[model samples]
Target: MPMKGLIWFRTDLRLDDNPALLDAIDKCDEVAGIYIFSENQWNDHNESNVKLSFLIKNLEILEKSLSNLNIPLITLNTNSFKSLPKDLNNFSVTNNINQVFWNNEFGINESKRDDLSAQILNNSNIHVSRFDDQVIYEPGILRTGQGKPFSVFTPFKRRWIENFDMNFLEIRKPSALKKSISLNNESSKIQYSKIHKVDIDLWPAGEDAAAARLSNFLELKSRDYNQSRNSPILDGTSRISPYLALGILSPRRCILEGMKLNNFELTSGNKGICKWIDEIVWREFYRNIMHSFPKVSLNKPFQDYTDSIKWRHCDNELKAFYEGRTGFPIVDAGIRQMLTEGWMHNRLRMVVAMFFTKNMLHDWRLGEEFFMKNLIDGDFSSNNGGWQWSASTGTDAAPYFRIFNPITQSQNFDPNGDFIKKFIPELKDVSLKNIHQPKQDLFSSSDYPAPMLDLKTSRLRAIEAFKTAREFNNS
Candidate 1:
């Protein structure tokens, strides 16, 4: 009798180049895979509808692929991180399995779950194996001369690129069907999604779809990415974030696709594509940061100095902003887009995040939590890193003094107001010049609320608050 194994699928959904999956196939004569819904994890983490819906759809596609490979997916409805081990063990013993395998996730609770699962499985002497698949490099892949994690991005990026090569990014494809062991195909023991995910019309699931999105972005839009990425109206960005977030697409494959578009002669054309690749590296940077400072996932700001800085509990104002009646066209547009589309452009994410955390004098965590609740592409590291960057509360943040003026950001980024017009129909009648500052008009939209607070006044107040906090610390 050969050793049968179980592969627990978490965020790494793609079949290509997964180190854990490859290694599992190599060592086990038979392998079965499962994906647990973990409802509490999603609720506690504030995962948005778009993300939730997208994940379910992706899992369905994943289930089909696994079925084709002779490994039927077992959908576990368990919610608690502590509940995983016993649930997995019960299945393993019933199925006569010997080992459990999975790719490791590094978030605070995710790590806890992995730890508890490993221990419980060990008690039963079921060998558990995990691997790194999501990131091209692990947490300490690039470090300073002192072996400390790089706090700043420029030097970190330089070191990251220097160490990056194609081989390290490679993942093995799905094993051939002939190699799979026979399974009980007739019995419908597991629960399958009866209703199609409602919002899935917006995003297609499956590995093939992820590949197509990558190909389309690299070939058609990537060269113009530098110029268009900031323009909210243009298809400047890859729009593959949902795929990336759900792990339907691999970052390794993303980098390879980017390299295909690279010219390396000048950065504007082919160079622009390389610059877009920098965004992927930025995602890697946050992951590395989170890994280095486990406290980040524990609700501690990357920069602890922001702790003494008092954050206002402006629930009414926060409610107004979240409802997309912020009176700043760009900010409102971004929020409205989020409500309708479940996604926001990368540049607009920065602008709205800064405005909420700085101009509104609200806590960055509040805004970060809101983003996670609303964004389809929300992931812990990226969302937290983005909000902190905008709020000037991060490890490598925008200088507190260099705050983004909402009106100027709108005019500069959504110059034509097409993105604004798409989300905010009340501003539809407003001209481009005044569109970004529609609140400057005598309360234009009866449907939309006026500016919750004045920008300049709030800006000064936030700066003073930070200065006062820092001043007391120095004293």
Candidate 2:
């Protein structure tokens, strides 16, 4: 009998550069794949339907790709993580698998589920192997001179550069199986309400599409990335984020491809290419943060003092913010874009998040959940890190006093209001000078609402709230 192996697919979906999948193929004569859909767990995590739909589409494409390699994908459905161990163990027994392999995922609940599953498999006399494929540096590998995880990004990045190895970017290509195996398991059906579905067609599914997008960006737009990335109106970004979030493309592949364009120099390269690489590193940094500080994965603030901060609750304002009727053109536009397309530009993400936590005095967790509930590119670590940073509640966060002024940010980034007008049609007729902060007359003539609150006063209020929380904590 051939040595049988099972590959458990999680966030690392693509076959290319997949260490766990490649390892399984190398070790066993015949390999099968399994993907378990934990609906209850996803609901508990506030996963967006848009993200779910994208994931299902990608899974279909991945299944087809795996089939070409003579690997059959077995889909399973379970309500939550608590049931995964039993399901996986039963599947392994029924399939008569000798070994199981998977890539590691970082999250408190995810880690727990994997640990239990590994224990169960070990007890069943089946070997389990986990690979670090999500990040270039395994979570605990990179540390400070003091033998601690670096809390700040600059020093962490410096060490990351210092410790950089060309071997880390090596891409793995799995060889085709010698013979095909028949599996009786059926693919799990995914159904979502019509209201929850977004037009995911905007993002084509598959590894080829992802690779094409990366190639196009590097060849055409990377030179201008640093210069125009902040402008929402311009196609200045790689737009490969959805692929990255879904694991249709790997970070190592992204870095390696980008470095090729920059003469294989990560630090001294085309400024735009280098900056884009920095952004990828930032993503890894957030993953490290989640691994080092698991409390963040559990909805706890990184800065303990932030827990004492009293957040205001206003249903009307919250609804307005959600519906893109907050009367702040830039913030509203960003929110509207996210609602419509299930994605938001990076710069706008920060601006709107800061507006929600500071100007609106809402809890950062609320904004974080809202983003996760809508964004197609929603990754827990990145979303949580961005939110906590905007709210000044995480390690290396912006100081509480550094609140962003929405109107000014709008003028600076979306200067001519092109991005604002694209999402908020009412502002199309408004003059460029008045579009960022439309006058009362313009609002009355058009359907646009006026500024919800005086900017200066709101900034002062948010500052006072932070100060009060810090003072109380000290007392």
Candidate with maximal TM-score: 2
Cα lDDT listed for each candidate: 0.79, 0.90
Model 1 over residues 1-475: C-alpha lDDT tens digits?
9778888888888787677777777788888887777677677888876677677778888888877777667677774677877887777777777888998887878888888888888888899998877687877678987888998888888888777666775556767444555544223333323332225666687788888888988888887887888888995788888887878888878887687566432123476777887888888888888888888888888877787888888778887888888777789888888888778888889999998888888888889998898877888999999988898889799988788998888878877888889988877787766777764546444465677778889999999988987887788
Q: Given candidate 2, what's the lDDT at residue 230?
A: 92
Instruction: Estimate TM-scores for all models.
Output: 0.93, 0.98
Off by over 4 Å in 1: 177-199, 263-269, 439-446
In TM-score terms, candidate 1 sits at: 0.93
Local accuracy of candidate 2 as per-residue lDDT tens digits, 1-475: 8999999998888999998889999999999999998878888888888888889889999999998899988888886899998999999988889999999999889999999999999999999999887788999789999999988999989999999999889786988898776555666775445246466888898899999999999999998898989999996998888888888999999999999999999888699999999999999999999999988988899999888888998999998999999889999999999998899999999999999999989999999999999998999999999999999999789999998888889989998899999999988898987888888874366877767777898899999999999999999
What is the lDDT for 261 in model 1?
Answer: 61
**Model 1: residue 68 alpha-carbon error in angstroms:** 2.1
Q: What CA root-mean-square deviation does each model show from the true structure?
A: 2.8, 1.3
